[model samples]
Target chain A: NAGVTQTPKFRILKIGQSMTLQCTQDMNHNYMYWYRQDPGMGLKLIYYSVGAGITDKGEVPNGYNVSRSTTEDFPLRLELAAPSQTSVYFCASSYEDRGLGGYTFGSGTRLTVV
Target chain B: AQSVTQLDSQVPVFEEAPVELRCNYSSSVSVYLFWYVQYPNQGLQLLLKYLSGSTLVKGINGFEAEFNKSQTSFHLRKPSVHISDTAEYFCAVSDAGGGSYIPTFGRGTSLIVHP
Candidate 1:
């Protein structure tokens, strides 16, 4: 079963270019999240959506946007990419549970800005 | 906002040896703690988590962690480790009673299991 799927596994964009990192999950999970992982910065939340038609900015949401118009898709958009935004982006989904928050993550999309 | 801190940046251990990776968080309210392991070029996988009851929680791959409320710590311990365990381990925390369930992750601890 394809739990979570992310597209454009690797991409190199010129400065000021914009693109969208697509993410879709077949588990029908209510919670979806986008996180960026840098070398030493660990995983920082970029955006999150609890359900369709709801989204919120996270710790490092600058220069990024997200929309959850449907339950299966939550695509992250990078507007005006910059060198500082070069990092691996991960998409995850989880069932609503207060105890033990285990997320089903997709293989991340590696993006680099030149 | 909650902050998680992994005491050690790296822990080098020989195969078949016991290992412990410490994790601590600073939060004013109740929080849920978790440990995740990330292999090379792979997404992080849940190693274990601490919810409410049972101070000691066991997880997959023979790993266990204890939630110490007074100390605000949830350190992961393994009685023995294998070479396959060489990866980066992360500690995360989320509010237990808050509305937003966003998690804050630590800097991560690299566990180098030498054969």
Candidate 2:
């Protein structure tokens, strides 16, 4: 099974442009997360969802919105792209009840804002 | 508030040498600790975690970490290093007392292994 999948492996957006980063998981996990990693910096949480129809803001949720409509899908939206938002975005999923196994991450989407 | 600190920003070592990446965390309540590795242009992968049980946790690729409650540290160690082990490592912490599932990650430490 495809553990986790993220689309648009690479993208370049002009200032003020907008785009959506799509994520999907086949594990039927209850927890999904969005994170962005900048150069020399750790991954910062952008958004998270405990389950379908539930979403919450994370540490760096500014300029981003997320929705969890189905168990398999959770997408992140950027209203207005900025240079500061240029980084590698990753989508992850985990089983909340089973805390032993850790999160599974997608390949990642490299976004560059000019 | 929960926070994780990876003291070293970069570590350079020769192949076949032992290496240690130091990590320290601060939290008022009980918490879960984790170490994740990210290869160049790749997503983060779980290296190991300290949820409960033994203080020492072993992970894939011959890596391990020991959780010290008193020092509030979870330092990753490897007896021998390979050039392939070069990557960025992150230390993260999350509260285990409640429904707090969000983890706070440290800035990250870059491990560079030279042959």
Candidate 3:
């Protein structure tokens, strides 16, 4: 099913620079999420979408934005990159809520902000 | 709001020895708990999860977890460890509310299996 896929396996951005992390899933999941992983920290959700055109902020939503235009695509936008934002990003999708099943995660995008 | 805590930051064990990673959570509403493993340079993968039905849930890689509602804990355990089992393990919780599906993850516990 190809599960979940993310583009730009790695990236480096300068202060104030902006970029978008692309994510797509072929499982036709109704839920999609963006998370960041720091050196010693666990994955923190940045944003999520319950369905196309419906999005919401997550625990660590500051400094980031997201849009879900289609059921298969959910992109995360970093408006002004900062060194603190440097981390590995993972995208995931699930068929239903957490009760239904576990999420399928993408390989991940490693980003470094200089 | 829901939150998770992984008691250990790092656990070192010899190969073929038993291991356990402790986890605790706090939430006012019902929650679904999960454990995910991340290998070096790899994405996080689901190790096990506890929803309803059973307090004991078995997951991939010969790992299992017991959900203790009284203690608000979901600890992952393996009968025997291997070098391949070396990875960072994260405990997570998600609200069971119909509208919220985002999960809250613990800081993470690094499991180092030494030969």
- In angstroms, give how far residue B96 of model 2 lies from its true place: 1.7
Model 2, span B1-115: residue lDDT tens: 6878899999999999999999999875778999999898778899999998999999999999999998999999999999999999999888888756678889999999999
DockQ of predicted candidate 2: 0.61
For each candidate, what's the DockQ? 0.63, 0.61, 0.65
Query: lDDT per model, in order?
Result: 0.91, 0.91, 0.91
Task: For each candidate, report what fraction of the true interface contacts it reproduces.
Answer: 0.59, 0.61, 0.63
CA deviation > 4 Å runs, candidate 1: A97-101
Give the 10-residue window scoring lowest on summed lDDT in candidate 2 chain B. B95-104
lDDT of 2 at A68: 96
lDDT of 3 by residue, B13-102 (tens): 999999999999987567889999989887788888888889999999999999998899999999999999999999999887764667
Better of 2 and 3 by DockQ: 3
- Cα lDDT for residue A42, candidate 2: 83
Per-candidate total of colliding backbone pairs: 0, 0, 0
Per-model root-mean-square deviation over C-alphas = 1.3, 1.4, 1.6
Q: In model 2, which residue pairs have backbone atoms overlapping below 3 Å?
A: none
Task: Assess every candidate by TM-score.
Answer: 0.96, 0.96, 0.94
Model 3 B-chain TM: 0.95
